[model samples]
Target: MSRLATSVTAALVVAIVTSWTTVVGDARADTARTQPCTRYTAILAPGTWETHIDADPAVPVGMLRPLGDGLQWQFGRDITVLYAPYAASAFDQGLTYAESLSTLEATLHHMVATLCGSTRVVLAGYSQGADGIGDLATEIGNGAGPISADRVVGVGLLADPHRDPDTTLSLGNPQPGDGIAGARSQDFGALTERVRTLCADGDLYCSLNATASPFLSALGKVLSGDPAPIAYLIPAYTDPGTLIEQAVTVGAGWAATAANLPTILEGLDTLPRLLTSGDIAAAHQIASGLNAALSPMVQAAASVDLTLVASVIRAAAAVDPSGWTSAASVIADALAYVDIQRIAFTAGHIQETLWRTMESLTRNDHLQAAAELAVLTPSVFDLADATLGPLLTAVRGDLALAVDTLLDIGGPESIDELVQLARQGAALASFYGSNAHIDYAEDVQTLLGFLRTQVAS
Candidate 1:
C-alpha cells in the first residue's frame, strides 16, 4: 500500500481510537506521522540517514518536520521522532520494564534499518527525553526508568544530568541508574564517549533553564542606566567587502550557536534542583569546583575570537546569582564557554581538532573524571537537557554532514538564513512553551538579539 494509503488507514484508526480510547492530543496527533513518508521520515530511509529526536510534550500537537536546515520550507526523506502517548495505558499498564525507552530506541533504530536499509540514525533526545536516559515513553517525565537503547549509530541528549546520584538522582533527575551513585552517564552512550558540559551560572530562577545572563546582562545594563558597551565595540563592525571571506566564515550558519546556548543554560540549572536543599552550601561548592576543573578548555582555545573565548568563561561564571555582579556577566561567561567550543568546530582549520578535543574529554579514566566533575563537583553535563539541541546533533555528525548545504541554504551572508536559524531556534523554544506552559517568549527574544548581532567581521 502507498504511504498515503497507510496514513489514511491510520488516520481512520486514530479517529476511532480517539473517539473510543481517549488518546487525544500530541500522541494521537503524531499518529498521522506513522505514514511511510518520504518527505521527512524518508530522510531516515534506512541508508539515507537522519536524526531521531524526541519531541517535547509541549511541542505542537501534530507531525512536525523541519525543512531546509530547519530554516525554510523544503523537504526530503523524513526522520521519525516518536512521541510519548498520553493515554493512561502508556503508564498504567502499557510500558513494562523490558519495554524500556531503550527498547523503543532499539525498535526505532531496528525498524529504520530493517525497513529503511541500515539507516544511520542519530538518537537526539530532549528534556525528559534526556533525563530518562534510555527510558520508555511513559516512564519519562516523572519516573525512575531506563531508556532501552542499543545498536544506534549516534545519540544526543539535552539538558540531562550527570551529577552525584547520592544527592537526588531519583525519579526526576536525569542521572542514569537506580540504586547507584555514578551511573549518571552509564546509559548515555553519546556523552560516555564524548562529554562536553558548557554551563551558565544563574539559570534556576525560571525553572525552564533557558535563561541567559548575557542577554540578561544586556538588559541589566539597559535597566541600570548604563549604555551598551557596544559603543566601544560597534565601531569595529567590518564592512561587508572586507568581511566577505572572514565574516562569511565566522557567521556561516552560526545561528546554530544561538539555538545551542539556551539548551546548555537550562541543562546547567538542574544542579540546585538535583541537590538536596539541605546541602545548598555543598551544591554551591560543587558548582564552583566543576567550573574550576573546566577552566583549562577556554585557555586551550584562546586563539579564537573574543566572543568564543568569553562564552567558555561564562559557562562557569553563570553558576549562581550572588557570585557574579549581575546576570549579564553570567550570560557572557557561560556563553563564552559554549560559543568557544562551537567556534572551534566552525573554524575550518580547527573543527576536527575541537571535536577530537571534546571527545577526548570522555576517554578512559578521564571519562569518569569529567562526568564526575559535572555530576559530583558541579555537573555542567546537566546543561545537556535543554541546550543539547545543536551539540548533540552536531556531535552525531549528521547535521555536520549538511555543513556545506546548511551553509548554502542558510547562506554565508544572508541575514534571512541567520533569522531562520534563530526562528528555528525559537521554534525549538516553542516546545518548552508548549510542554511546561511558561511564557518563554524570551527564549525567542534571546536568540533574536544574537541573530541581529553581526558577529561575522
Candidate 2:
C-alpha cells in the first residue's frame, strides 16, 4: 500500500480501538480494588529481553539497588520486586515490546484489583524494558490503559527509546522529532509532571542530531521501503559551496601551521565519517542496484560540490606552515563546513543507503530475513495485536538462519559483539547506541526520592 493509504487505514483502526477502550472502561466502573493494601509501594521492572518473568532486576551494582534495597531497609517486608518479562531479543523487539506491554498491563490491573486502595506503584525499567514502561506511562497518562494515572507514585525510565522531546523531566538536551521508534500518536500530558527521560549526550536513540538521524532514517527506510520523506532533505543540507562561501566571506587572513596539518586532516576524515557513518550498509549496498534509481540524481547534485570542498580543504592546508592559529582556524573552518551538511544529509543518506541495502538483500534471496525485519516499522497502530502476531511467533524458529540474517542487517559480527559495542559507545561515542541504553545509577536515587514523597507513610 502507499504510505498515505497505509497511514489512513492505521488511523481508522486506532479510532476504533480508542472507542472500544472508552466503552469498556465505562462498563467497568470499579477500576480500583476496595481493599486497603498493607504495603504502600510496589515496584515493577521489565527484563530487556525474555520470554518469561525475570527472577531479578537487571541493574549494575550500586545503581538502582538503592531504591529497592533502600525501601527494604526502611520497611523490610513492604517492598516487593515484580519483574516484568517478555521476549526482548533484538530480532523480536517488535513482538516482545508489545507482548511485554500487554503482560505489564494485565499485571497492573490485577495488582490494582487485589491490592489495598492506598498502594502506590513505582514503575522502572532499562533499555527495551524502559521503552515498554514509557509506552505504558504514555497510555495511562492519556487515560487508555488499565491503571489510573494517580496510582503511579513515581516512574523511572532509564534509556527509554520511545522518549518524546520536550516532555521529558530528566536532564540532558532535547532531541529532534522523537525516539528511535518515533513518538506515540497521543501525548502523555497526564504524566507530564511525573515522567523523566534521562539521556546523555551522543546517545543516538534519543537524539536526532548528527549521530542519530542517519542510522534511524536508514533503519526506517529498510523496514518500510520508503525514503521520500528523508530523501527530500538533500537541498535542506548545506552545500559544499555554501561552506566555502562562508569561509571566504570571513576573509580572515589565517595561514596554516605544520603542527596543525595532522589535526586538520584527522578532523576532516573523522567529520565526514561522523556525519555519514550511519550508512555503513548503504555504502556497501548502494552499488548493488540503487545506481539505476538514485545514483544519477545524487551524482549530478553532489559531484562538483564534493570535489570542490575536497580541493579547497587540501589547498587551505598546503598554503602556509608558520602561523600557529591559521592552521587551527582552517581546521575549525573545515569542521564548521562539515557540520551543517552532516545534519542535512543524515536523513537523505539513510534513505539512499537503506534503499540500496534492500535491493541487494532481495537479490541475494535472503527472503525470510528481509520479511522478518519488514514488519518492524514504527506505526501508530499496534502491529503485535494485529494480524502480524502469528508471523512474529513463527519467525522465532530456525534460530540459526534468523540470527544470521538479523546480524547482517544490524552490521554486527554477533549479538555479543553488538552488546559490547553498545556498552562502550552508548553514552560517549557516536556509534549505534542510545542515550536511554546506559546504566543510570544517579537516576535510581532520584526515583527513590520521588517514590518516598509519593508514598508518604
Candidate 3:
C-alpha cells in the first residue's frame, strides 16, 4: 500500500508541476525589475497572494512597501520591488508552493542578471512568499543560485514555511527542525551572517517538529489523497531543524486554534478517542479529515490537547513494543481510528462544530482538559511528561487566561475585550512558540543597519 501510495504521489507531483510549469513559463517575464542603474537599494516582497504588483508605488502592499518607503525617505532613492506572480492560494499549499519555487527562482535570476552589479538587494517575504524567498536565500548562500552572496544585503522572512531550526538564519528561539515543506538542499552555511528568519510561535508551517511532522505529512497524504504535498515532510523530517520548528509550529497552531475557539474544540472533543483507539491509521484519517475542515488560516493550529494525542498514541503502541517491527507501523496504527465518512468537512459543518466544540471545551470551567489529562494511561502520561509536559505546564496560565477571555467574549460583551483577548492570545502564542517575527520594527532597523554597513564597506 505504501509503495502504491508513493507511486501515486510521484505521478501527481509530476502532473501538478507540469501544468504549473506551463502557467509559470510566461509569468517569469513578469518578475518586475527596476532600472537606470542608480545603485539604489532593492527590496523584493513576494506578497502571499498573486495579486501584488510593483506598478504603483503609491499603494502599499506586502512587507516591502513600508520598509521600502522608509528606505526611500531616508536615502532619497526609491527602492525597487521585485514582483513575482505565483498562486498564493489557501488549502492548496502544495500547488502554490511549487509555483513560488519556480517563479521566484526565475524572477531572482533576472534580477541578478540585470541589477546585481549596481543594486544591493534585500529580500523579504510573508507566508508562502516567505517560503520561496527563504529557498532563494539558501541557493545564494550555497553559491548555487543566480545572485552572488556579497551583492545581497540581507534577507528577511516572515512566517516562512521553510524555516529550519538548525540554520543560523533565525536568531530568535531554538526549534528542532525545518519548515513543513522541509529545508533547502544546501544549508545556508554561507549566509549565516546575512540571513534573518522570523517564525511566529505556533506557526506550524515553519516550525513543526521532525519527529512528529511525518505523521502530519502522512495525514495530509491520506486525507488529501495526494502525495506531492507529503513530499515536503519526508525531506523536512531529515533536517535537523525539523524538531524545533515543529515545536514552534505546534505552539502557533495552538494559538490559532485558541483564537478560533469553536474549531479547536471540535478537534479536541474527538482527539482523545482517536489517540486511544487500537487502529492508528483510521484515527489518523479521521484526524486528517477533521483537520481538513479547520480554517486554513488556523489549520496549523493544533489545539493544546494535541500533546495528549501524541502521548496516547505512543503509549498504545508500547503494548506491542516487542511485537512492532517498525516504528512507522506503530505511528500508522495509532491513526487508524477515525472514520472520514462520519466526519464533516464542509465550511458550514466546521463553523457549527466550532461553536459546539467551543462550548464543550470551555463549559464546566474548562474541566475537559483536566479530565483528559486525568484519564491518560500511566504510560501515556509518562510519554506526555517526557515530551510536552513542561510545555503544557509553562503555557497553562496563558491558556487559562485565553479560555476565560474567550468565554467572556462568547457572551454579549464589548468588542474591546474580545480584541484584547486576541492580542493576549497572540502574545501568549509568541511566547510559547517563538513568534519573535512580530518584532518587525526592530528587524527592519537591524536590516537598515546591515545595509548601511554593507554600503560603507
Candidate 4:
C-alpha cells in the first residue's frame, strides 16, 4: 500500500479502537455500580463542604471516613460500602439545606432500588449529613420511603440537627437541649429502635436553648426548609398588641444604640491611631468592646422588620397623635428612603466582617487583624454615613421622647428589659464553637461496635 493510505488507515484504526475501549470501560463501571451485594450494604453521607456532587464513591472523606473504613475492614468481602455523592453545602455557601436534602434522598433511593431486597442496609452521616440521614430514616420508617423500613439494619448520626431525644437512641452524655434546628415533627416510626444519634455537649448545631429564645428557634426552622415558624412570626409582628411590644422593643434597641454610639464612634476614631501607634493589644481590646456593643445592633438590624416597625409607629401615632406625632415624623422620615432588605443585607455583611475582625484579633494575627479592620472600618463608616447616620442622630437627639411615645402606646414599662430579651434571642443563634461536633472520630469505635452488633445479627 501507498505510505499515505497506510498512515490514514492506521490513524483511523487507532481512533476506532480508542473509542471502543472507552465505551467498554464506561459499561464496566456502570455494571460495577449497579452490582448488588449478597449480605449487606452501608451508605454514608458526609457533612457540608466535605464532599462534592461528583465525588468518587470509592474514596470516603470527611467526618464519617473512619466509620466507612471500619465497616469495610470488619465486613471485608461480605459487604459493600458506598459513599453518597451530593452538593453538601449550606445556603450561604452554595446550595440550600433543602437542595442538599433532595440530592441525598435521591441518592439513597437509587441505591435502595438497585440493591437486593434481602441485603440489609446501614446508613451513617455527620452534621448536615446527619440531618439528611435522620430525615430519610423518618420517611422510610413512616412507610413512604424508597425501601421497607426492615431493610435498614442500622443507622448512626453525629450532630443531627433534627435529633429528637424522645425518639432516637442517644449515645453520648445527655445534651442540654435538642438540636439547634429543633426536633423532627414526626417520629421515626418503625426505625425508631434501629436509629441512633450522638451529640457532643456544647455543640450548638445539635443543642440550642430553643425555649429561652423562640425567635432563634424560629429562625433555625426557617433555615432548615420549614416555613411554618415564619407564618407565626409574621402575625406576631403585625398584631396590635405585638406591634406595640415590638415598637417598644425596637425603640429600646435605638435607645441602647444611642447610648453606645459615642463609645463605638470614639473607638472607631481611636482604632486607627492605636494601630498606627503599634498598640495592638489596646486595639484588640477596643475591637472586643466594639464587637460586644455592636453585635446586638447588627443582629437587630438584620432581624427586625423596619417596615413593620414603621407601621406600628404609624398606628401608635394615629391612636395618640399628641404623644407620637414628632417621634413618628422622625422615624418615618428616616425610614422613607431606607431599603429594608438592603439594610438587612448590609447589616449581615457588617456583622460577619466584624466577627472576622474580632476573631483575627483574638488569634493575635496582627497582619490579618489589620487587614480585616481596614475592610471593616470603611464599611462601617460608609454604613453610618449612608444608612444609619440619620436614624442614629434622631435617636440621640430625642431619646426620651421616643421612649415616652412607646410607653404612651402602652407596652413594657422598661424598654431596656425588652431589648435585653431581644439580645438574648440573638445570642441563641450564635454558634457555641464546640469541637465536639467535628470530633466524630473519637466516637467512631462506639459507632462501629454498634453497627457490628446490629449487622451480625
Model 1 over residues 1-457: C-alpha lDDT tens digits?
A: 2344434533543454344233333343355446464322221111001112232332323211221123112223344433332221111122211122222333333233333333323333332233233232212222322322222333333332222223221222232222101123233333233221111121121122212222222222221111122212212222211211121122212333433333324425544454434233344444444333333333333443546323322332233233322222333333333545543322222222223334545464555434433433222332333235534543453333334333544456532243342332243234323533122233323322221221110
Query: What is the C-alpha lDDT profile of model 3 across 258-280, one tens digit per residue?
Result: 34434334544555565565333
User: What is the lDDT for 94 in model 2?
Assistant: 21
- Give per-residue CA lDDT, model 2, range 279-331, as digits (tens): 43533343222222222223223323433333333334332232212332332
Using lDDT, rank the candidates from best to worst. 4, 3, 2, 1
Total clashes for model 4: 0
**Of 2 and 4, the candidate ranking higher by TM-score:** 4
Candidate 4 residue lDDT tens string, 1-457: 2344434433543453344334533443467668754588898888877886567666879888888888889888878887876667554333345545556655656656666667789998888788878888888999988889989999998888887787788886767677767888899899989988888766766776665543334335455553221222233113222333444455434445544655666765765576567565676676666655555445445556665554434433432334433344344444434443454454455556656766777887868877866665565455445445655554455545655664665466644433543464334323332365566666677888888889888
Write down the TM-score for model 3.
0.47
Model 3 stretches with alpha carbons more than 4 Å out: 1-35, 50-59, 90-96, 169-177, 212-457
State every prediction's TM-score relative to the real structure.
0.23, 0.42, 0.47, 0.58
Task: Give the lDDT of residue 327 in candidate 4.
Answer: 49
Cα deviation of 245, candidate 1, in Å: 53
Best by lDDT: 4
Off by over 4 Å in 4: 1-30, 33-36, 226-434
lDDT of each: 0.29, 0.42, 0.46, 0.62
